[model samples]
Target chain A: MLIGFVWLSLTKAGVPLDFSFLKDFSKRLGDGFWLTVALSLASLACSLLIGVACAAGQSAKILPLRYLCNIYVGLIRGTPLIMQIYLFFYIVGTAWGIENRFAAGVIILSVFEGAYITEIIRGSLLSIEAAQIEAAKAVGFTGRQTVRYVVLPQMVARTLPALTGQFASIIKDSSLLSIIAVTELTQTIREISATNFRLFECYFTLGVLYLCLTLPISFVSKWLERRYDYGN
Target chain B: MEIEFRSLSKQFEDHKDVLLPMDFAGDVHALAVIGPSGGGKSTLLRILGGLIAPTAGQVWIGGEKVCYEGAAVEAHRKKIGYVFQLGGLFKHMSAIDNIVTPLIRVHGFSKEQARARADELLGRFGLLTEANKKPAALSGGQQQRVAIARAISAKPKLLLLDEPTSALDPEYTTEVLGIIRELKEERLDFVIVTHEMGFARHACEKVLFLAEGQLLEYGDSDTIFQQPATYKLRSFLGKLLEWNI
Candidate 1:
C-alpha cells in the first residue's frame, strides 16, 4: 500500500514513471536479467573455491602463505570494486589475454567477492570452540577427521546464511561490470535508455528486475539462517 | 591404571605456572583430583590426555612413557578418552551421530558397525529415545552422557574426565555421576577432576588434592577426606563442606 502510494505521488509530481519501453525492449531486458543471474552463479562458485582456500591459508603454518592470504584480503577489502574492475580488466586482462567480457566479468566479480567470503569462512572456523577440537583430539580423531566430522558441519551452519547473502552482493556488484560493457542487466538498460531517451523508465525497470533476482535470494538466506540454526 | 608424573609441569606464555614441577605416582581404577579453581587440575588432566604438551616433565601411564613428539603424541592421544566439563558434543549432529561419526571417522568403523555400537551405548545409557536429538535439544545430563559414550566408544585404555559434571545442575549432576560410577563398577580406569567431593571420596579410590599449582596432598580417598595431612587440604575441605546442607 505504501509503495503504491509513493509511486502514485511520484507519477503525479512529474517523475514520468513510464514503463512503456517494456513492450519493445522486454526481450533484451530478459536476456540481460538471465545474464546477471548466470554471472552471479558462476562468480559464486569460483569465489567459494577461492574463499575456502584463502580462509585455510590465513591460518597456514607457512609464514609466506599466511601473509599472502592476509595481503589479498587486506588489498581487496581496502579498495573500491570499481578500481579493481578497471585495473584487472584493462591491465591484467590484456597481459593475460582475457578479452572475453563475460569471462572477464566473472573473474573480476569472483576476485572482488572472494575476500568477503574468506572472512565469512574464517570467522565461522574460528567460532568453533577450542574444547570441541580438544574433544576430537582426545577421541583419536586425526586432524583430517576432526576437520571433516567436527569443523565442517558446524562451519556450514554458521556460514550458509552469510554466503547466501554474499550472493546478493554479487548480483548487485555485477551491475558495475556494465562499465566495461559486459552487457549485463544494467548495461542493457543503459543502452535502451540511450536510444529511446527513457532514462527513468529504463532504470526503474532495471531495479525491479534486479530486485526480482535478489529479493528471493534474501528470503532464502533468511530461511537458511533459521533452518541451519541447530540451536547453536 | 598406574600413572606417574615425573616432574610434570606446565607454564603458559605469560610465564605463569599452571602446573608447577610435581612428582606423584598412583595405581588405581578411579583417581580424582579435587582442588580450588586455578589449581591446575584441568592442566594436569590435559597433559595426561595428551591434549597439551607439558613444559618440562614426563607422564607414564600403564608402563608407557607419554611422548610429546609428533607421531608419538598422536599415538598417545589415540589410546585415551577425555571429556570436558561442558560436554562438548558436536552441536550440528544428533546425539547418535555425535557418537557414530567419531567411531566411523576416527576409529575406521564401518557405517553399520558404528550405528550398532551407538544404538547399544545410547540404549544402555537410557538415551535411546533421545538419540536422534541434537545436543542443544537434549538435557545437560544427556549431553554429558553422550560425551562419555563417545569417549569410551573406541575402548581407550584410560579415560580423562575434566570436571564432566561441573557445568550441570544438581539433578543433572547426579545423572552424570551415576554413569561415571557405573564406569567404575566395570573396572574402567579413569581420572576425574571434580568439585564433587562426595563422589571423589566415595566412588574414587585415590584422591590428589591440588592448590595454587602445587600438589598439596595425594593419598587414598578414605584417608585424605577423613584425615587431611596438609593445612591447605583441611582448609579447602572446611570451606567446601561449610555450606553443605
Candidate 2:
C-alpha cells in the first residue's frame, strides 16, 4: 500500500519514472556490485581470521597474550568505524605510502568487523557444553587439536548466521567507502544522479543493486546453518 | 592397569575441600566409586583422567606418578579413557566417526584400521544400526554406547567412567550394563562412579563408598553389601536400599 501511494504521488507530480537510465548505468553498477562483493568476501575471510585469532589469544592460557587480545578487541570495538577509516587512510596510509585505497578500505573494514566477529565466535565457543571439552581432553586430544577438531567445527556451525549477517552489513557499510572516492556502487550512483539529474531513479537503482547482492548471501547462510544444526 | 591415589586431595579457590586426602594402592579388575552429590566422585575421576589437576599430592595410574607436567600428563591421559554420565559424545561427528577419528588422529592408526576397530566396538555394543547416526540422533542408551566405543578406541589400559548410567532410564541402563559386563568379561580394567545400586552389586568386584569427599567403606562388593562396618557406610547403604535404587 505504501509503495502504491508513493508511485501515485510521483506519477501525479510528473516525475519521469523512466528506468531507461539503467540501460546505460547497468554495466557500471554491475562492476560496482562485484567490487562490493569482493570487498565483503575478502574482508569476511580476514575478519574470521582476525576473530579466531583474537578469541584464541583472549582465551589463551598464557597471561600476556590474554591481556594483548583483550586490548585489541577493546580498542577496535571501542572506536567508530568512520574514524578508523580516517585513521587508516590519512595517518597510516600516508605514513606507510600506501597508494591503494581499495586495500585500505578492505583492511579497515576487516579490523573494524573483526572485533565484533571475535565476540560472536568467542561466545559460541563458550556456549559449547563443558562436557564436550572434558571428553576431548579425556580422549587424548591436545589443547590445539581439541580447539581445531572438536571446538572449531561446532563453533562454525553456531556462528554461521551471525557471521553472514555481519558480512551483509559489511556490504551496507561499504557505502561509506564513497567518502574515500573509491568509485564503488554508491559513489557511481551519486555520480550518475549528478549527471542525469535523476536522483530518485539513481537512488532506487542503488537499493535494488544492494538487495540483489545481499539476498543470495542470506539464502546461502540459512541453508548452511540448517545443514550444520546437529544439536537441534 | 592398577590405579592408586596416595595423599591425593583437591581444594578450590577458597581453600574449601573438594576431595579430602585419600589413599588407595592396589590392583583390581573393576572398582565402583559410589557416593552422594558434592562428594567429589566426579572430581576424583577428573583428577585421575588428567582433565583436572588436584590441589595437592599425586596420582599413580598403572604405577606411573601423574603430575601436571604436559608430556607426562598427555601420556597419562592416553592410558586412561573416560566417560561422563551424559555420554559426552561429539555431537558433530557420526557415532562411528566419533570412535573412528580419535583412533586415527590420536593413536596413529590407519583409517582402515580405525574403521575396523570402530566397527568391532560398535558391533560388540550392539550399535551397528545407529553407527552412522550423530549423537543427537541416537537415543540416550545408544549415545552412551558410542561414548564407550570412543573411550576404548585407543585401547586404553584403564577406563574411568563418571556416572555413565546416571542419566539413563532403566531400559537404557540395561543396554549399557550389557556393554559394561562385556568389558569385564574381556578383562578390561575400569573404575565407574555410579548410583545404580543393582549394577554395582552385580557387576563390580569392589565397591567404594565416599561421603562428603571421604572414603568411608571400600572392599569386595559382596562383603560391603552384606556387612557395613561403619555407621556412615551402613546408614548410606540403608537409605539407598530403602529407596530401592
TM-score of chain A of each: 0.95, 0.88
Instruction: State TM-scores per candidate.
Output: 0.93, 0.91
Quote model 1's TM-score for chain B. 0.97
Residue-wise lDDT of candidate 1 within B1-245, one digit each (tens)?
Answer: 88898888999999999998999888968999999999999999989988889999888999899998777888888788888888478888899998898788777899999999999899999999999998999988889999999888888899889999988999999999999999989999999999999999999999999999999898899999999999999999999999999
User: Where does candidate 1 stray beyond 4 Å?
Assistant: A14-20, A62-65, A90-98
Model 2: per-residue Cα lDDT at residue B189 = 95
At residue A2, candidate 1 shows an lDDT of: 77
* Pairs with backbone N, CA or C atoms under 3 Å apart (clashes), candidate 1: none
True contacts kept of 2: 0.77
Flag clash pairs in model 2: none
Q: Against the correct fold, how does model 1 do in TM-score?
A: 0.93
Report the lDDT tens digits of candidate 1 across residue range A103-202.
9999999998999999999999999988788878887777887888888888999999999999999999999999999989999999999999988778
The top-ranked prediction according to DockQ is 1
lDDT (Cα, tens digit) per residue for candidate 2, span B148-217: 8888888889888899888899999988988888899899999999988788888999998888988888
- Can you tell me which runs of candidate 2 are displaced by over 4 Å? A1-16, A60-80, A83-100
lDDT by residue (A106-206, candidate 2, tens digit) is 88889888999999988997888887888888888888889888988888888998888888888888888888877788988988898999899888889
